[model samples]
Target: MAESKPKFLILGGLGFIGRNLVKHLIDQNAASKIRVADKAIPETAFLSDHFMQYIQHPSVERIQCNLSNPMQCTRAFKDDHFDYVVNLAAETKYGQDDTVYKQHIFDLAVNVGRNVEEHKPLKFIHVSTAQIYDADKKPAKETSKVKPWTKLALYHKQAEDELKKMSIPLIIIRPAIVYGPADTSGLTPRFICAAVYKHLGEKMKFLWSADLKMHTVHVRDVCGAILHLCLRGNPGEVYNLADKTDTDQGKINDFLGILFRIETGFVGSAMSTMAKLNMKSTVEGVNDKHCQPWSEMCKAASITNTPLSPFLPQELLYNTPLSVDGTKIEGTGFVYQHPMMTPVLVKEVVDGYILQGMFPQPKDYPRPTPIPPPSFETK
Candidate 1:
């Protein structure tokens, strides 16, 4: 007799990470059937052309429903029996108020947790942010102290707590700033925009200390990690997903400056200090102005209408740097495809954005040739 194929359900499948996960599953032929539930339709979801084929594929099902609504979530899961259910739905905007975060992020997690508890899928994987950890320059472990320095992290921590209280077996993954192709959220697109604006000589100053650590994981690695956890991860265990390389804003700025061939200067500690003095009001004011051109560019490029906040709240920045120890996930026999955010990787992402019309490559921009991944050295 032939074995039955595994079925998977991805809530928030239209999101930056969720879309990539769906593509990864389909490309790997890992599932017999897949269901994608989200509040946005394919059009409004701002999915790239690469995803259109999968969305139209016979084995995939796209259901549009607000996961925040319990009745909708209930209906969405009523008749489906999934081997795996991955929850990527959450309010990820960085500048929102606590009330907004609690309602959209925390409440959504509770709703999904309750439904997962009821459905009892074979495995439940929840995507979390690295922001839960305090700003320590050292690599943070899953066992590290969780001092949420931002409202976004605070609410996500609350959501994690709510999920822990649920009866369903859960695998929690905390990922650093995720970037790569098809990335409209996080830092990728914003960096692209900054490069464009810088090339145009519109914005020339970096916001925070250039030395601030900027831990990151590629979206594909994130997908790979999620799959690894689903198959081999122990239930009720937490893993931090990040690369071994120690990347900081200074390194990123240098790369961007070289890539764009534009000389830029850091804003320095004095300005950052003032910004932190009145963090909320200052960030909101600056971000609102920045969002104007960003929104316009996104609209022109058909990308998702994501807000353009390059930095988190000032208080969060002043806290310890949010670096992490990804050895836990790596020890599970998973290797990062793009371990370090090298120049080649950054070029690939920028090229992807240019292809999508989100970024305009400068006429004189020197495009770096693609390089193969580095060979891992064993101790």
Candidate 2:
């Protein structure tokens, strides 16, 4: 008899990466059944109809539960045996209190890990952040020093440590600034900021040096890596899921400049130092500048409510670099379909929101180059 396709469980499946992963599995026809367990439902997730069809596919199942609670975590898994369980659930917000981070991040991950250990899936993939690495000039390897820059990263590191001790076949993936369609954090905020500048018809300026690393990986590549690592990667190993972009602030701004048709620049060291001294005020000022214009654009477009926002937290505004080495995953024979950060790719993200009516598509801006349909044909 022929073997059955793998049974998959995606925790936090309503999230950006999780939803994309579900799409990947369905597109590839890789899973016999996919169970999506998350705190939110499809209606509230702000998922595009393009993705809604995939989530509501005949092979996919939806479950609602908070993974932070142990009872709900157990309920999330149920009695069924899943072949692959990917944990994408966590408090992704920045600038939260220690207790919020503790309960939602560390506590949630431990609860999920304990449940995973009990069920013992074939492969348990935990999505982590690359922010745990020390901010340095060089790219951080998986074995790099664990000096978390933000409170969010601090708990991620702690969760990683605890999950490491579990007897389950666990594989950890730390991605650098995951961006693409349905992204609120990551590059979307910067895109919105550039849009604000476009409306103002002014050059966009950043606080830090142009060279500050803000390494990025597309969400498609992130989803691709998760599946690749699940099948071929060794259990009990950690992998970094960065692209070959070598993306820094300058590269990102350059792409944004071309996409938004706005000039981009950075403040010099002296001004940046002053801004650093009063970071709270600086961050507030920047956010204030962007939010008003963003709201105006939404109003002009007749959009009542949108999940997208230009408001950036102070933690995200800091100069800390998220440099990471994606070559390790390449060594495993997994290729990044979207290797570089390009203007077209950035435009693609904006275009997705525009199509969803979540973002204003300015009539004054120049027409964008025609983009081909999303493809992972590189592999």
Candidate 3:
């Protein structure tokens, strides 16, 4: 007789990482039944056709509920005994009010954590961010100084601290700038900016030094690590999930240049420092140039609607390095599928949106071939 597939419960299942995780489980045949609990439904999530097909897979069970509400969160876990419960729900937007973070992120995570204690899954995985560390030249370890540069990171750190007090079997994963399909917040903005610059026929320049540390990891690796840790990680352990690449702003720009066929550079620190002194004006100046031209490009292509945009919130526009060390997770015998970011991989992100008709097709950019999901390593 074969072993029964592990049952899974995924909180925030329709989110960027949530949807991707569900797809990963289905592709690997890793789960018997995946109950996806989230506030938003699939039809309203603006998922691509490629991702939509996977979310609607036979093994997935979608349940729409507000995890922020304590009653709903408790009921979400009472439905079945799960082998693994991964929490991917949170307020991901930057530059929001403190109240917003309190209600949606810090409060909601606590609510879910309390309920997880009652249900008692084999492993309760909590997704955190690399931003909890202070921006520095050195990569941060799990035990690094807790000086979060962003408000979102502050709340995540708060939640991490709170969740530690509980008796739940917890495994925390902190990932560096996660980039891939269904990524609206991470590197997608820069991709949109590159396309905008291509349309304007100008060199794309950025604030801060080109060598600023901007570590990254692919979404596939994130999902793989989550599953790997679910089976093999120690309770009360925290892991940093990043790739081998020591990616910097310049490295990312080089790939963007290749994809958009445009020139890219950074304003020297002298000018960038001045810009930072007056960040509000600087942010408005940057967003002002991209928004109108992007609209014009979409209009020319007859694309009346798209989720893609070149807007960067003030918090993200700040000159803070997000360097993170990923070597720790490797000690657990898990390997990254995309150990490094490449020009082709960066181009693949833009091409994916283009294929989905969410992004304006670049001139001379060939149609993208369907990318096969690489075999996930659970061992």
Candidate 4:
């Protein structure tokens, strides 16, 4: 049996998800101790006094190290001898070239896995991405067919394969577009873009068509899922941690417009097509290969019984036949606390970014959806 409150070492512990996990673990008292490391933690104003409070303590240690460098990676594992090691470190961009991604980032995933195997921890948790699922489907589960092409998808897939081959007892979690307070990557920018557009009172058109799907989850919820898997998930198994609802691009846009009080319009089809038609590699001259720096127009939307909106970008929804079946995790007694709705997440992320001052304010930032009181979203 696993020791109660195992000591944890989190290699990618300072990135968006890593930070959330550390915060959550502290608040919940989920671990005996946590050692966090990353290439370099970017300094941001978004970190609050509360965040600073938690950053340094007897219970945690933060380090600057690159995992792709095997010597640095091996030294961490040998020095710590931790009970659980979560590899949340990855170059999580969707619009970058193959060479840039593999060299600087993705190989880091394999490196972490190798170190975990060498260290022989009680459990190794690999936080991966759901991009591996073929965009042709929506709400894809662990059983979903794998697609090998997407740059984002391949990175995690390769990591999983390499780790499994090494016989590491791992818990792999693939989450969709994640957003919430303190987010430095992914959908936060779209909110910044939308918020600034709202402030400017400028009419902005979405790059993707109305029907595309953009699955999302709150950063806190993703943290919860990771904690749950660490506490109770089956090793050598994979799970998809995403919004309960399979939300689409059109719905996300309409909701955000309503919440922010902006008149929103959408462009149709994939931005890739838009780029192709324009004879460029990207819309707005942004390279699709390095999609990590910003959010991308993902696949088409999936229909779901759960209604998640009132603030999501509708045009951003592309249909993804992927549907994540979380029954196994549910069976393991895992529970999700957040509503997994777009508006709810959008509110948290947008407000958090504004508070951080990282998001630039536009003169006409639109305030369409009247800010809901904290009690409004009460489940």
> Backbone clashes per model, in order?
2, 0, 0, 65
Kindly report which residue stretches of model 3 are placed more than 4 angstroms away from their true locations once superposed. Answer: 1-3, 371-379
- Quick one: ranking by lDDT, best first? 2, 3, 1, 4
Can you tell me which runs of candidate 2 are displaced by over 4 Å?
1-3, 366-379
Candidate 1 weakest ten by summed lDDT: 370-379
Candidate 3 TM-score, C-alpha based: 0.96
Model 3 weakest lDDT span, ten residues long: 370-379
Summarize candidate 3's per-residue lDDT along 131-244 as a digit string, tens digits: 999888899998898898999999999999999999999999999999987888999999999999888889999999788889999999999999999989998999997888
Clashing pairs in 1: 135-320, 135-321
Full-model lDDT for every candidate: 0.76, 0.88, 0.88, 0.64
TM-score of model number 2: 0.95
lDDT string, candidate 2, 223-298, tens digits: 9999998889889889998888889999999998877778999978998999999999999988889999899999
By summed lDDT, which 10 consecutive residues of candidate 2 come out lowest? Answer: 370-379
The window of 10 residues in a row where model 4 has the poorest summed lDDT is 299-308
